[model samples]
Target: MSDQGNPDPTTMATDPTPSTTGPSARRRSLFKANGVPRSPREARASRIALDARERKRKREQLIMGKRFRSHFEDYEESDSEAEHEATPTEIQEINRGLAGSDEQVAKALKLLSARLVSPSAALEKFILAGECVPHLMRLIHSPNPEIQLQATWCLTNIAAGSEALCHKVLDAVPYLIQSLNPLNPDLADQAGWCLGNIAAEGPAFREHLVANGVVTPLVDLLTTSPNSQLTQTACFALSNLARNPGAPMQQLFDAGICGRLVKHLSQHESQDVASEVFWVLTYLTAGELQYAHRLVEQDVIPHLVAQLDKFADQGSAAIPLIRTLGNLSAIDDATTSRLLDHPEIIQQLLYWVAKSPARTVKKESLWVLSNITAGTKAHVNKVLKQDGAAVLTEVMSHDSYDLRREVSLGKREKLTGKMIRWVL
Candidate 1:
């Protein structure tokens, strides 16, 4: 009831008019213009219209997606929109502006960056048509570090698009790495970001990163810089480098990325930095045998365990860290022993298995346990020594269905039920 002691303004008005059936009057009246009671037909039509509008919206989104993909894939120079393509004279003018006063060059690069960041395929094609990529690289060498930074930023954005754009940006790698010197931390950070974009493409560009000598310099940035942000960005750059499945990884291992990343993991002072380093190591271990051997040889497992020990309570880094350890643990029987030798690591995995609310963490934890058990009998005893039997039983009875299935599947072999019974 309203304050006036009625059924609020929403109550039917006493006046039931027949011909004054406008929207508001209809809302107020209990009878329609025909003096009949309200019916569901009108409301039904409205709902149907809303449903049709929703379907139309979905169709439009699908068409937009197709356009984006088509634009990204169309690389033929002749097929590019001619109107967006700058004239040769205009291209020469922009080129001259790039070599003008340091400030003008910086502004020009910034302008290019702003345009590149736009979703306009026409603008991206225009830049490509003008063949301005090589010029952008030279701007990285300008006496002014700020100009170098803007150029690097532009390169990074241009490199972030599809393969066409990445190929264009790859020309700037040698100069990009040069700007990553410690003396200019800001320039170094942005340069690292740019290299990361270039590396994010497929194997061809990742190899370009290696061919242009990017790994060691990136590792240098991770090690030499005081800025956690820079280190994290460097880690990002390396992770992309390590992601390609068939890319040659020997050079990356030879660069000491293993020990560096492990050390970075232990420095859990910054969870963000530790997380990035953990991902880099994780990808490295997931690669070829040489990559896993190098990371394990660097004693990554201990640091991986230590990372869990340090940040387990935080709950953010625990799952990925455990997964990385589990991946490394599968290297071989000896690597499993290395993981078993670290009983605390087993306990850490058990802790997550039993406590983490995420089934993914619990599943990975159980998988790692299964890997450890698959080793020599001594390894099984190492985990059993840590009360893993009880942890498994608890997880089996966990309320989460996925967790229970994961644990059950992980222990499906001979040792599972027998191990549980033996421990009990």
Candidate 2:
């Protein structure tokens, strides 16, 4: 009799193959259509299926996992205690489910993705210890979009752990890159987020990302994605990729990322998006002088200057804008001259040095001034002409040692004897 009417496949007994006299026959005969196993073999099969069902139910309970939050923004590290500790047996079962049927794999991924949303170092360690990364990498190729998305999500969080744990997920980089298609923005967003976390690990991993050709698609997404969240996430990933001290700026420049970043900085309305774009520019400009010049060629300086007043009340946002200008100024007198070409840029820096409430803003502003003074004597005179000397004197007397140190450095840079007396 066919078992079509049985609601639970686990309890349905399959017809035994016809073997008139062997052990197969004996085992087959031991089970009834009613699913009452009359022998050890049938009983074991029943128990295994029941166990699988139970595990599936347990996994389903965790489907309502935590909502998605970008690791780049407000990511809090988990304490020593994990919110839900997984036992060795539980991890083993999850791993088994990963290798099980399609339904089981989906449920297992759901559970894994759910738990990883919060910062649970121990849980990540436990999962890694179970050797489940290969399974996750495999699932990234699953035709099922939900499973593919969940697998990517799990890896994203895993990459958010320590550098060692992130290394374990590196093999998924290629598969993650494949998911960057603009047609699937949600999956692309998750993949971009994962790549960002991996790139954030260090230089080698970033090289891995770039070597795998992660830049082209990321730039594509940044430029073409209609979904603002995906666009922002792509920007975040590119920023991390460019963050390396040994970053492959040539590859990024070849990919035309610098121009795109400037476009977003000038046109994107979201402060968060603009802030991340600034970071990308900041890191890129911090590299070889060519990158700073490329940004200038993109007409980035005037856009950056315009943002100073817009982000003035926002210290976090304002800091990067100041730092980017400072990086340009430090490049050389020619680049510094580009910034000085805008007279308000100097006035703005002096205003922040004297009046901005954030110590970091004042510090970065003074740092830019120091770079300016480090340039030709004309740059120093321009700063002094803007009342920069008085600002330095006031800052030098402040209680903040860091600010005073910055002022002292600025005072020492090419200041005339008259300017020195004014600051002193």
Candidate 3:
């Protein structure tokens, strides 16, 4: 029996023979009508049939080509047929959809949000084609939680586009603020992301948020909320706002964010929130060194120092932790003294440069150390002795330094009876 069925009806059985099995001849199925070449006339008839089949196949191919060509040619001019397919403009569609039901508006905003991730031209196309931003701005106020959530989500991503594109949702700031309330943490989280993007833009966009008085309440959410999910999102928003250089540092500091962030940093065990605190600290310290004193007074330095070990070989915290340390230590007097005063800070920085898994951590540790040497005479002398000397020399060999100035720390401070330091 054949594998596929009982047997092919067209197949025939034949007796085994040397001549039939040998290469000189081949066996044939005895039961098939055309199993063997009975005569030259039979073979000739089979060849003719095959020729006809080939001609039929070519004819069919030609017909198919003509059919396709006809369809292609008529496509553009099929207006009369397509008249039934035409619909309203994109804005009209959105307005029409919104007028129907809550789910309808939510779905429309979801479609708009989905397109926001496209390339700039595509995003602009959707916005211009649908007049999306204005409709999104209006839909954000709908009483439905999901509609508000999606509107904020779309508005956030839209603002993440180019500066001109982001301007479209600037008017929606107040709505985003309203969405940040506690009735729905999910919606508030979405609103946080939206406002964060707006804050990430240039000075004008940031100024708009500040001018609208959105900063204080946003910070308050992170500081006061016990809900980790909502607080996590809020911290991320503030971090992005702080990322841009010259972001309103004093303004944020004045809002009591500094002290609250310090306290929040101490209790939050989640690395995500901790990373945001580090980033915000990095930004705040970079913009205004004066804020360093404020942070130290809040007793945040020890907590920041503790992160060097907690994240030394884990997660995304190492880079930011090291960066935060470098920024804090970069302040010549107030912050540097505070860092040295903190327990094991110098020892931790040394070990990090010597054994930390990442080169970035090691380099940032060196950064902190070099800045440390610029402090009081006692600070320079402390690194000159013990294991600190070995790491300091390793740092020197790996990095370029102005040896003339480096060796002259506190009027020629010496390491192990020899004067040396790294100027980086």
Candidate 4:
């Protein structure tokens, strides 16, 4: 029985092939009875509907195009807006923060000391430049070593690189030097870094320091300070003193800084200290071959050779160590030849050339190899016969033109024309 709730109108109609008469055809027929459009009118209405849709789409495209252009041109304005947004509302705030009194400066110095490694570079710049040295000096007496340390670093950075700041820094030197004796590593490092900066500005300040007997305290620090940073900085300062072509160089020699530096070189655990010691020696021995024999006599070559391998594991040390060696080799031909004779050095270098991935180490290795082989045909033959030509040739092709010329000239003097031609 058919359910009365269910419409049986289609079943009663007895239409055959119900599946063939699709709903679309039926709806079209029903539309004709409902006063809808005829065939021609229906086609016209469809065209109108399609035209409306296309117009809507074009309007949307125009809106989107306008949006894109606005976005593109607004970049500069937006950037300016962002910059304005970041114009540091904190300047007036910092000034206000710093204004109250001596106690306020102390509090700011303490707060700044905590912010030394802050994510804010602005805060660091402000702390370094804006604070009065006197204020920092007051905080230096605070029971906190960190506050003293930060105050020292801020002063060093402010004074180190600027000649205009030298007098200002010199004014602060007594306090800074006093801070050097503090048992804190941070304070010691800042003091040493400041000294290096002063010496780096050239012979003027260096002579000033030496003439004032500052080198004695600095050298004594190198000897007694267990702090690596301080010792290294002291050595760097001494190097600058020795680097002076004036009376300060003689002063360093007289002060016995050279011997102390050599002793510092062998004993330090810090490669940085070792590297600077070598540099100090380099500066001392530079142009004057008189010290070359002394350096060799003191057996500096073996220690340098031992440190050559140290560069393999620590790549940053490689360039400085290699440069130091090159400078030493440039001191005199005999010392250069003596350093070349160390079997372990040559082997370690050759091994690095073969295995080390560091481009700097490889370049340094090539240079050290070239320096060792220079002025000695026997050594060149030993290197070339050991199949070092390919590496040397590669270095010649890849290095700077000046270096390439030096290498080529040095190689030519060592290898026979036939051997040189064969390599080239």
In terms of lDDT, the poorest run of 10 residues in model 2 is 1-10
Question: Where's the lowest-lDDT run of ten residues in candidate 3?
Answer: 1-10
Segments in model 4 whose C-alpha atoms lie over 4 Å from true places: 1-103, 110-131, 137-147, 182-185, 239-247, 351-356, 396-403, 412-415, 422-424
Kindly list the per-residue Cα lDDT of model 4 for residues 101-159, writing each as its tens digit.
55665454433332321214454345447554556566556665555555565455444
Relative to the true structure, candidate 1 reaches a TM of 0.67
Instruction: Give Cα distance to truth, residue 158, candidate 4, Å.
Output: 0.7
Ordered from best to worst lDDT, the candidate numbers read 2, 1, 3, 4
Candidate 2 overall lDDT versus native: 0.68
Question: Which scores higher on TM-score, 2 or 4?
Answer: 2
- Taken over the whole model, the C-alpha lDDT of each candidate is 0.62, 0.68, 0.58, 0.52
Give the clash count for each candidate. Answer: 0, 0, 0, 0
Q: Which candidate's lDDT is highest?
A: 2
Q: How accurate is candidate 1 locally (lDDT)?
A: 0.62
lDDT by residue (tens digit), candidate 3, 367-387: 666677766666776666536
Query: How well does candidate 1 match the true structure, expressed as C-alpha RMSD?
Result: 17.0
Off by over 4 Å in 3: 1-101, 243-246, 395-424
TM-score of 3: 0.68
Question: Where does the lowest 10-residue lDDT sum fall in candidate 4?
Answer: 1-10
Superposed on all Cα atoms, model 3 deviates from the true structure by an RMSD in Å of 23.1
* Candidate 2 structure quality by residue, lDDT tens digits, 200-272: 7778988889889898888888778878768767766776777646577888888888778778777788776
